[model samples]
Target chain A: MLDAKGLMVFYENMLALNNVNILCKENQIVGVFGANSAGKSTLMYTLSGIMEDIKKKEEMAGGERITVSGKIQYKGIDITKLRPSERARRGLILCPERRRIFKESSVLENLRIGGYLASPAQANKTLDYVFKLFPALVKLKKRVGGFLSGGEQQMLAIGRALMAQPKLLLLDEPLLGLSPLMQAILIRATKVIRDEQQISILVTEQYARPVLPIVDHAFILENGAAVMEGSRDELLNNPDVRGAYFGV
Target chain B: MEILIYGTINSIALALMALGFALVYGISRIPNFAHGAIYVVAGFITWTFLKVVGLGYFLSALIAILVTGILGALIYRFMLIRVRGMAISEIIASYAIGLAILEGLRWGGFKGMTYTLPVFIAGSVTLGGVPVDIHRLLLIGIGVAVIALLWLFTHYTRIGLALRGMAQDERAALMLGIDSDRMALLATAFGSMLAGLAAIVLLPLGNIVVEAGYNVLILAIAVCIVGGLGSWMGAVLAAFLIGFAQILTVVYLGSHYQMVVALLAIIFTLIMRPSGLFGRQKELEERV
Candidate 1:
């Protein structure tokens, strides 16, 4: 299980996330829906330790400029202050929104490099599984990553993350700019990965409609706050959420 | 025929000099302007060692190379790393070091005297009816041999491959868990050693002075710009091209304008081919 409680984040002096709490059960797909500039990227970057500004509610300093803060517990261990690579070692992997792929390198080479922070023996075992999960990537393994289409790049990104044998994969805005066909492919693939690998996934998305059915639970964020969080069915049925977020 | 043979030897020597700086730039991503100081320092130090301490020529050269390596490492870890990512600042830093080193060498030990080295060989070689100093010819041979070895190292060795990877993309290299600092130290040592070797060889043929590197430094930098960073093959080719051009210029227009032509060629190459003739193509890889 993953739990984040009483988390506060500040950058300089401004608050991005304030006193937020979350719980994700093992092997579950959790989604966070938010508008642009709603502090989604900051939240994800904080979780990954790339942007380090955590705060306890007691320590909040009229906070408005700081980034991510809060207790993020994974498997009962507090990972709030862990280094990014240390987090990866403990199976808290991030597919980073832009998918930092090494261009001029082949798809397989990029994947192998991503697995660098892992043990070679384990990475090799997981490499076969990653290929099986994203067979499209397997065919393009020898091709340079820079030449891949957006969808293919996204597949390679997630495939690289999975190559690390992640227990909880944090994806930031996975479907933000992808085409409808690509979005569908990603959703279907993400579902299969969760079920087959028994890995938990927390994906952020701007369009909730497409992401609604696949995820078990969700939190709707607006203006840097989690307005509501519940089972997917509840969020689907809520009139306020539908009117405000889904534009129903 | 006389001009052609002399020009070839001169070109090869200048090419070897440029390789010294190119090696450091290719690995560390810092345009090391202070490398001229290495050439001048090694030359002066070797002259002093063999003349004052009565050491053999080769032994003095070895000592100078070892000292230069230590200095190179010190400059890297203490100075270059501290001010990297600020290109303008780094340029200023290297120039300051160069100016300080040049001036320091003048006052402290050399005392503005024109120091001459014992000739490595007395005879001249008559090649194609052109008589050239045998020692100068020997320096040209050594330059080619060193360039060949450097080529083999980059194309085949593990550390050389890592240096290339770092030069192309430092962040990506780090993502691969390569400790770039260690690689950098090794590169500085290797580059300084090569430069020192060139200095030791060239010192015997030319007058040794505190500011000895000024002429050769410009030649080397031009070679690097023309060769392209991160490309050893490019360096070798550019070195020869610039070298021969310098000699030919001296033959036709005299040595007074040799540097002017090299600079003009460098500027022309910069405008015409920013990546140089053999430079690696920039990969527009997305990094978001």
Candidate 2:
């Protein structure tokens, strides 16, 4: 389980995220729905500890001052100050926005790199699971990641994140720019991964319809603020939520 | 026939000099300007081990390589880590380290041409009616072996894959639990070892003088600039291109013009293909 409370992020005078709270219980799928510039990616970065890295880089370059204040509890540990790599070592893996897969590496190589923290035996086992979860990747093993189609790249990205053996997976816009069919396949696979692997997932997206079926609890983020939070059924009954997120 | 044999040998030597520079830059994007200084230091360490400690040549070389590796790691940990992500600072910091090491050695009485490493094997062999020393032949063998071993290491091992991933995308690698600092430190250490290896193999041909460090640094930079900065294959190919060009210049234009070939190659590559032969900038632009 992971709990993030009172998270606020400021990029100079601009507020990227404002006093937002999000949580995910063990083996649960939590959906965060937001539109453009809704701080979805910022939230993901904050939770995954990548914001700390960004802040450091910005400080080194004397660029925009990034100020982050939050308290993140991951499985009972205070992890707000942890570096991304350290967080990753504790199984807090982030499949970042835009599918950020290693473009120059082959699909297998990407997966192997993802297995950096795993023991040899664990890596082997997870590699098998990843291949099984994304069967389309098996044939594209040797193909370069940059050359892959958007759907294939997203699959590889998720597969790569899985190779890291995540206890809590944070997926940022996994369905972006994908066809409806591909989205369906990925959403189905996401559920299957949760059920089989018993991994908690915190997935963020602009469009929530395709992902609505799987997520048990969901939050609606509007302009860096969490506007609503409820169970899937509770959210579905709200006409405003349906109209804004599901376009129903 | 002479040109062909000598050209290949020259190319291999150039590759040996540039591989470490390319590797550290490739993985960590840190242009270790101290590469050449590390080479000279390795040579001196080997000399000390063999002459002062009365150790065997092999043992001395091995310990020297290890010490230089640690030296490289220390450089990264203590200095490069602070200036990281700032390109100008990174270059200045590393170059300063190089200058200090080279000048420090000179000040410490490590100058002059009397210091030399013994050749692994003696005598010369005739090939195609052209005579070549056994050591040069052995250098070629070691060069090829190093290349093959590096290829296998990067392609097959877990750490190698992680390093490649780090080279391609640091944030993505971090998401997968590969620590950037640790990887950078490893790269600097391994790169230093490669530099030391090159020194151990090549120093037998000449004296280990501090001035050689400056020449090696320039040559290494020329190769990296001509090749693409971070591409391993590009560095190797550029080494051959520059190497053969250097040898050809030496044969046709006189030996003194050899350095001119490398300098000219660097200028030409910058003018015609700023990204070098296999630079990633073009690909990145295309992707964008």
Candidate 3:
């Protein structure tokens, strides 16, 4: 469903993403495993066209000189130069790192805001699906987003993205700062969403063990480079992968 | 009794004047320094349509509001779009636009005390033994109605919800397909119309002079600064505070001190709390 080739992102003199390639087939969950500063978020930003926005903002502020070179194709259409909002309209939604929820809005309002591109019926249906997928949110419908726990916030973030009716959902570090139990729940839900909605997902994580069981294809990123690529079992069987990511 | 009635009316008027500035700032982080120019221009447009063009009052007012909205959209599209994300540039460009518009109108001969709008109703009623004009009473009603309508619009409508989302977090809203540029344009247009509304409602009580533009700008800035830059509720509360203070000054220290009250409120708020009363920026700073 999505293909990105030869993606290179530079921040001044430092390279954030170096000659990397990633793909997500229809109805597939692709895992990107990397440590801190591994270019995972940069990859997500590049794919979702947020890099263009960041580049423009940085340029306007006269801050960093960010350079991004890449070709991104979604559903066989080149979308490298599309704005983030345009990409989102075409169903490329990113649930960004840190669960950037509208802190002042209530959970229900957050979901409503997420339904910006959706029709009334589509929004209502997706909203119902989101609440069903994250049933815990049903109880906290009126609670403000900032007051929610980290786990609840992550759930809300995913639910909010689902409200956008994404064809390809990019989950950037969904497991960060989450409890093991919450991570397990989120991983399981991620798989169920793919099965139920037929939506492709690209999830990035530092630890791959909890997510490995669900991802069909996995890539390991090291220092902005794609070091390894294989199917789930192919990665799980490797001693180095198991030792470094699986903590075995 | 006179003080109470006049204070309430004056407070509502101040709230109306500042609402547009506060809203544009809140949604797009654009200060919209052209707010006062829009107000004066809308009043002039309505007067032109009414007297020179011989149109009816309602039609002229409606046309003026629409024209002002388009003017605002044009300002954003042509001028403000490039300087966006740069705070100083946004302010300077908008203020420059405001200065040009006000000065242009003055040069174009939209001066003197002869330009005055007719009140919607021409009667006075006794309120607590004080004679209050129907227009002032109508202004209060319109002010309350505008606030209520704005609340309902933001809370219930799809576009309004998207706007609120953008106001809270621009990038997150973008991730959900809410176009920030479109929302900002809509905000600028709506805010200009709000300024127009204030002009149409309040100008009937006095003449439409070019100098009123500068006074309106200063007053709007003072109220917005005192109320916390982007909070509507804060603007309303601060308006009442400063409104009452201005009324009391006019009653005791002479009417000339009315403008002084607004300037003093701005200064005091800046000195006491730079963030104003309900500022979220300060909380975010504290968190960091």
Candidate 4:
């Protein structure tokens, strides 16, 4: 239900995202696999409209000139120039890399803050859903966000995004810096969220093995370009993809 | 007994004055240098309503606080929005606004001891052989209530929680659909209303003169700086520290040396700690 075409982003003379096109259908989980500096995070930032804010700040400070050109259609509406908050209001929320949870705030307060735009009934319902999805968070409701472990913080970040009631959740490197077991648990929860809540997910990761099981379609990005796109089986069957990404 | 009674009263007053400045800085990272100007303007507005418009004290005070809040929001929306990210520009612009307001009021003949708000209560009562006015007791009561109410607001309310999130990590808050500009505007408004509230309660003890505006601004800055820039608890504790110190100076040395106490506290804090009593930035720096 989301289509982005001909998306190009440049920081001065350097291209950060080069004519990238990505899509996610309704009730689908899409995976983007890449190495460091592969423009995966850049692509996610471009989609979520945070690039607009960074561009404004850079221009105001007379720093690097950021040029972005794209046509993003979500549910048949073009939202290329929308502000980040406006994009979020349309149910496109980003759970950013590094899990930028509010450190001083308690877990419950972080979730409550995420429900800023939700009605009381909706927030309450989603809060219950989030707690259920991440049972580890139930016991740490009163704990400060900074004190939580990296795995717990990732769960809280995803749960906080869910509190916003996203139709399409953009997860940028959710598995970064987490143990293998934590990655497995998050992958399982991601599939569960898609299955039970009918929310579309676009998740990016450096390693594909843990995340590939849940993704219906996958895209391989290299040097700011999308090199390949296919169903999970198509990607898995490719010997080159197996050697480079899947480690099969 | 006299020193103890007056010191508590003085400390609470300092806390009330610094609370608004601390709040705006804490939430939005805007120093809001116009806080003192807003305090004076609220006093003038209350005076106009009470005397010229013939409104009662409570009604006038309420309306004045509301007007100052809207004034603060408009300032952020129209003026400060242009210079949002630059720290130096924010300070210069807000201080310029404060200068214009304070000087503008002076130019408009709002001078002298003519403007004074009537105390909420009249006369005095003896406490342990030290007589304190009823109005000062009411000030202490209101100050405690304001702090309690503020604590509850930040902990339990929706917008308040969002503000706390914004204060901690603004980009993360924005990603969660909490509008940053809207939250900053709300913070400015709430902070200005707090300054107005402080003025309504504190200005009644003496004439509302233009000089008090500058003095209040300096004192607020001193409290914020000495307490650590954006820490709420730091500001309160610093206020008590400075307030008691000021009272002690007035008692032992001389009343004229009272302002020196606040200035000296600021200098000592900067030299000894640099981050004040509880600066989070210093901790972050140390970690890095």
TM-scores of all candidate predictions against the true structure: 0.71, 0.99, 0.98, 0.98
Q: Per-residue lDDT for A52-137 in model 3, tens only?
A: 88899999999899999989999999999888999999999999999989988899999999998999999999999999999999
Query: How badly does each model clash, as a count of residue pairs?
Result: 14, 0, 0, 0
Give the TM-score ranking, best first: 2, 3, 4, 1
Residues B1-288 of candidate 3: C-alpha lDDT, one tens digit per residue = 999999999999999899889889989999999999999999999999999999999999999999999999999999998998999999999999999999999999888888999999999999889999999999999999998998888888999999999988999898888989999999999999999999999999999988888888898889899989888888989989999999999999999888989998899999999889888755753442
Whole-model lDDT for model 4 versus the true structure?
0.92
The TM-score of candidate 2's chain A against the true chain A comes to: 0.99
Rank the candidate models, highest DockQ first.
Answer: 2, 3, 4, 1
Listed per prediction, chain B TM-scores read: 0.92, 0.98, 0.97, 0.97
Candidate 4 lDDT over B1-288, as tens digits, reads 898889989998999999999999998898999999999999999999999999999999999999999999999999888888888999999999999999999999999989999999999999999999999999999998998998889888888888888888889998988888999999999999999999999999999998888988999999999999888889988988998999999999999999999999889999998888988744543332
Relative to the true structure, candidate 1 reaches a TM of 0.71
lDDT of candidate 1 over B154-186, digit per residue (tens): 644546655655665554444334446666777
**Chain A TM-score for each of the predictions:** 0.89, 0.99, 0.99, 0.98
Q: Judged by DockQ relative to the true structure, which candidate is superior, 2 or 4? A: 2
Winner by lDDT between candidate 4 and candidate 3: 3
Give DockQ: model 2.
0.73
- Model 2, A34-119: lDDT tens digits are 99999999999999988888888899899999999989999999998888999999999999999888888789988998888989
- Candidate 2 residue-wise lDDT, B32-111, digit = tens: 99999999999999999999999999999999999999999999999999999999999999999999999999999998
